[model samples]
Target chain A: MRQIKLKERPDGMPSAKTFQYENVDVPSRNRDEVLLKTLYLSVDPYMRGRMSTGPSYAAPFKVGEPLNGGIVAQVMESETEELKEGDIVTGALPWQEYIVADPNQLRRPEVHGAPVSSALGVLGMPGLTAYFGMYHIGEPKEGETVVVSAAAGAVGSIAGQLAKKRGARVVGIVGSQSKGDYIVNKLGFDEAVNYKEENVSEALKTKCPDGIDVYFENVGGEISDAVWPLLNTFARVPLCGAIAAYNLSAGESDIGLRVQMPFIKSRVKMQGFIVGDFSEHFREAYEVLSPLVKNGELHFEETIHEGFDKVPDAFLGLFSGENVGKQLVKVVEPEQ
Target chain B: MRQIKLKERPDGMPSAKTFQYENVDVPSRNRDEVLLKTLYLSVDPYMRGRMSTGPSYAAPFKVGEPLNGGIVAQVMESETEELKEGDIVTGALPWQEYIVADPNQLRRPEVHGAPVSSALGVLGMPGLTAYFGMYHIGEPKEGETVVVSAAAGAVGSIAGQLAKKRGARVVGIVGSQSKGDYIVNKLGFDEAVNYKEENVSEALKTKCPDGIDVYFENVGGEISDAVWPLLNTFARVPLCGAIAAYNLSAGESDIGLRVQMPFIKSRVKMQGFIVGDFSEHFREAYEVLSPLVKNGELHFEETIHEGFDKVPDAFLGLFSGENVGKQLVKVVEPEQ
Candidate 1:
């Protein structure tokens, strides 16, 4: 079996050397455990926080331990009555070729007429994050402007489309022209700004003439600064991630927001969250989002890495703004 | 009659030069207007946002116009049936000795044993801000550690005392030793840290050994940098003010929180709010807060400025971190 481990913590930006790939013997399943081969691994921006030894909402990965992620795997062997061979499941598995999971931790795929990889993106955590972040926290009203950063990324693309279906005026902020165009023309955003080219604040001023009412914040940093001035009274900001400032080394200071005072003065609500924190809302989110996906009213994009060996490279690309849509690694062949 | 107008737009921190104290004839009351003799003026931190030309939750004060604030006044003449001569009321009135007001715009105080000045601090907006900002946003659970910045100030003090009343561990962060001692020894905060003297992070680490579950933010900037590292998972931050950053002049470079990305990883909920947004919760807040105050379960202190002429000087002191508790401007003589 092949696994990826945290070799050393990166100072600023992570590189290939930050992760160590190892070949290991696959462990046998105990009494109630099922041995499985990982078919796909989810590569998300949130993993950056796990690399640091700071006080994170989640625990940091110890150096030399195999990096863990949400993985879709097929059961190769079962040691209990509940599971059988060739059954596909999803669970928190490592960045490895195979994993042994308790059946209680395994969730059978819920998607119909869609690739299993959907279980990692729109049908899974990323999709639910967008759903709960917007609906529960954002409470977006009809005809209100909803702004989203990382517009073409896994979570954002879904968030924008969901906002659109709810009759909100959706504006997307992306890093590239292609991503911007995709969100506007293909994904149904009212307008999209390429932050790499145009000034985000200026574009936002033009697009959201009345001001942004809901901000689904996936990328924090300069983009956050731009969005602050445009927030209207009672604006809701659902802070999903801050991929922009993840890798600051010693000597490099953290970029702080000068707009914090304005947040209080403007009565804006900025809430930071993780998908795990909103699990209770999953069933409701699925009830709403599942139909949108089936009716083609909601669409998602994926930047797929070919195999398990490419997981580290895929994750490292997140900080550099390389991947488009939800990033994932195909770890094994699908069963017939 | 006297009125205070904006002489000029402030360059950075507001000074006396920005205000013009002029003697103008008091306008006559219309058929529906009541003549008011100003007795007290409420000066608040949010007024700083109005001083700027930048967009705020409320419209910025126009240059060359009279500065408006919440004021307590006695009805000198009444043209409306609802208000009579000698009746005391409070509402948004300009900074002046006498003025004409529409009776519909005033709310009569239900002042029983409490002083009318309490309406300006502990029983009014600042008090409401602390009440709702804590209950609605912070959502402090029993036994949770609550950390509040600007602990000696109006809203912060009330927030700290409220947290303690709710059975949570409260730690206050202040700028001076005296203010720290007053809060811990007198007002009953479990602990207090003078952010200016000691290493804040170390102090917070020691005081909040279990980690900060709720952070009532009043002073942002460097103080927030230290507090960010000590927050616990599912922590709630009610960001009520960022008084530290209000003095930045034009063309000042951005000072972003470089390490704030952990908010996402830790799943911390940081929300900013203005008091009026939760108007529906005001009665509910008063229902809970009033009994605490009447029973002396909630302790409060006020830093009263001697006269209305001292309003500009009192406001300037706020930027310098000079106040010990709630800051108020006395528009008339205290009861003999």
Candidate 2:
């Protein structure tokens, strides 16, 4: 079995030297445990926060420990009644070729016609994150202008599509022209902005003449600075991530804009949220999002790496704005 | 009659030139109007937003128009039976010596035992702002650390006291040592940080080892930057004001950290609110706050200026950090 471990904690931007590779034999399952062969490993931006020693909702990975993330695996051996051999399952598995997991920690796959890897991206945590965040916190209304950053990425792509489906005038902000074109032309967004080239705040105002009523915040920093002033009264900002400054380690950056004061003037409601905080809403989110996916109302893209050895390289790409859509790694080929 | 008008919109910080004092005859009272003599003029941080031509939640003051603000007034002539001559009232009144007001625009003194100026400060908009912001948004729990910026100002002072009243550990962030001592020694705060002399972020970590659970944000520039990283899981930030950045006309200052990822990492909930948004909860808030003021459970301080002509100077003092506690301009002498 192959495993990836954290070699050192990164100070600012992480490089390939931050992780180490190891070869080990697959461990046997104990009573109530299921040994599974990993199929797909999820790579997300939130992992950057975990790389730091700062205070966060989730604990950071200790140096030399194998990194763990959401994974889709095929049950190889089951010593539990809840799962049978050959069953496809999902669990928080380490970056390894195989894993021994508690059956309680694993959920049986209900993919139906969708690919198993979909559980790691659009149909899984990222999807539920967009669903709950946009619905519960953002509370996007019909005919309102909905703005989203990282609009062609895993969660953002789905969020923008979902907002468009809800009859909002969806304007997406992306890092590259390719991503921007994808969201506007392919995903049917009303407008798209390449934040790298175009001015986010001005573009939003031009496209959304009525002003942005809902902003699904994926990238924080200059994009937020641009979007803040354009937000209309009673606007809702569902802050999910801030990939822009995740690499900086000189404590927090000091971009002083007096940003929060807009809340009082415009009465804008901006809420920061984590996917794990609203786990109870997972099923509810899936029930609502699944039909949209099958009916082609919601579509997603994945940038998949070939093997477990590539996991570190894929994760490092997150900070450089390299990956398109959800970044993921293929651990082992699925059993027929 | 005397009136204060906006001579010109301020480019950055407001000054005496921004205001113009004029003398005029008082208008005759109409059927629903009551001729009012100004008692107290409330000068608040929010007024800064109104003086600019830039878009804010409230409409900007048109050049050459009288500046309007919350005031405690006395009914001199009542064409409406709702108010009688000699009755003290509070409502939105322009900066003036005497004016005719509609009866529906005013509310009688709700707390007879406490000073009426408290209506504009601790027991009024700023008080209610602190009340709902702390209870409704911040949601302080016992043993949790609640940190408030602008610790000695109108909204934050009351917010810290309210948190302490609820059995929470309250730490205040202030601009000066005297203000810090006032919050800690007089107001019963567990600790205080004078940002001018101390390393705010480092001091905050030492004072709040467990991390901040509730942040009452009043002054938003460097102080907010210091407190952002130390936020604990499920932390609540009630954005009240941005006095520090209110003077900046445009262009972002480098503060070092951006909030995107930190807010998400902590699952922090930052909400912006104006007291008027919760007008429905005004009575509920007043019921709790009034007794606290009357019974001495809650203490308040005011920097009183004598006369309506000083209103402009007092209002401008907000940006300079000149006034202590709730800043008010006394327009009338005490009457029995």
Candidate 3:
């Protein structure tokens, strides 16, 4: 078996050297446990927070420990009736090729007709994130303008589509022209602004002539500064992530325009949240999102890298806008 | 009649030059109109927004136009049966000694047994601001920690008291020692941090050892910077005013520590609002607050300027933290 561990905490931007690959023997399973082989692993921008020693929603990943996150695996052998051998399951697991896991810790992904890897993206945490944030916080009304930053990414793509479904005039802000084109053409966003090419503020002003009623904030900093001034009265901002500030060096404050004056003038509501906050209502979310995925009404994209060795690069690529959508690593071929 | 007009838009902070005192003829009343004698007029921090020719919740005060705000007055003459000649009333009106108004624009304050001047402080717009912003937005739970900035000012004072009444541990951040004493000793706050005397961030950490669950944001800038880092998960911030940045010069951005990362990490919800946003529910707020004031359970302070000529000074005193509780200008005695 093979495993990857955190070699050292990065000072700012992480590098390939931050992860250390190790060879280990597969551990035996106990009663009610299953021996599983890793199939796919998810690499998310939020994992950057867990890598740091600072306080966050989730506990920091311990130094010199195997990095763990959402993983899809196939049960090679099962000792319990809950799951059978060759059954596919998904849950949070260690970065190992083959390992022992309790059957209770994982569940069969309800992917419907979508790819099994969709369990790591649209049918999983990212899907639920978009569902809760857009519906519960953003609450885009019909004909209202909704702006989504990092629109081609896992969460934003789904969120923008959801807003469009709600009859909102959805405008996406992306880092590249291709991502912008993809969101507008394939994802059905009303408009797209490439922050890297166009002046986000001016472009947004032109596209969202009535002002933004809902701002789905993902990549913060300059992008957010551009969105603040254009928010309409009673605008709702669902602060999902700040990937732009994830790699700031120690003591470097994430400085930008103040939100007080604009917020007060517009009577805007900005709320920061994570997907787990709405775990109790996840069934409600899946009931809605699963059908959309199955019916091909909800579109999603995945940028998958081959082999477990590519996981670090896949994760680091998130900050540089290298991935069009969900970034994942395929560990091995499933035996099911 | 005497009126004060906006002489010119102030580049930054307004001075005596910003106001023009003029003599004008008293206008005649029409059908459903009343001639009111201004008794007391409010000088609020939010008025600074109106003074600028910029987009705000309320329309900007046009150059050469008389500034208008919440005023307490007595009807000298009436053409409708809705109000009598001696009836006391309060409404948003011009900064004039005597003016003609439609009865539809004014309402008699239900002051219970409190003074008529209380109509402009604890029973008027400021009071409603604290009521909604505290109850609807802050929603501080028992034993939770609530921090209020500009604690001695009108909105902050009332908001802090409201949090205390909710059985939360209340900590107030004030500019002066006297203001701090007023919030802590007089207003029943658990502790007060004098931003001018002590390190605000450090003092808050000491006082709110459990972490801040609700923050009543009255002043922005450094005071807000201190509160963000100390907020607990699911904390709520009711942003009512930002006096600290009201006088910011043109093209000067109101810069501070970025809120994105902190807000996301803590899942904080910050909402900016005015009293009018909750106008439909003003009766509900009054039902709860009027008795608190009449029973003396809700203590209030006033820094009343004696003459109409003192209005500009009274309004400017808000930015300098010279006044405690509500600041009002007494124009004249009621001509009943």
**What does chain B score (TM) in every candidate?**
0.76, 0.75, 0.76
Model 1 residue runs over 4 Å out of place are A29-33, A257-336, B254-336
Give the alpha carbon lDDT tens digit for every residue of A36-126 in model 2.
Answer: 7776655555666677775554579988888887777787787778998888888777877779999888886444345566555545556
On DockQ, the leading prediction is 3
Worst 10 residues of 2 chain A by lDDT: A261-270
Q: Candidate 1's residue-wise lDDT over B224-319, tens digit each?
A: 777765666556776666666565577674364321322322333334332233445544534443343345432223345654334334433432
Report the lDDT of model 3 for residue A21: 71
Model 3 misplacement above 4 A: A257-336, B257-336
Q: For model 2, what is the C-alpha lDDT against the true structure?
A: 0.64
Which 10 consecutive positions of candidate 1 chain A have the poorest summed lDDT?
Answer: A258-267
| Candidate 2 CAPRI assessment class | incorrect
Best by lDDT: 3
Clashing pairs in 1: A57-B265, A57-B266, A254-B258, A255-B256, A255-B257, A255-B258, A256-B255, A256-B256, A256-B257, A257-B256
lDDT of 2 at A133: 60
Each prediction's DockQ against the real complex: 0.06, 0.06, 0.07
TM-score-based ranking, best first?
A: 3, 1, 2
lDDT of 3 at A237: 77
By lDDT, highest first, what's the ranking? 3, 1, 2
Error of 3 at B268 (Å): 14
For candidate 3, report its TM-score: 0.77
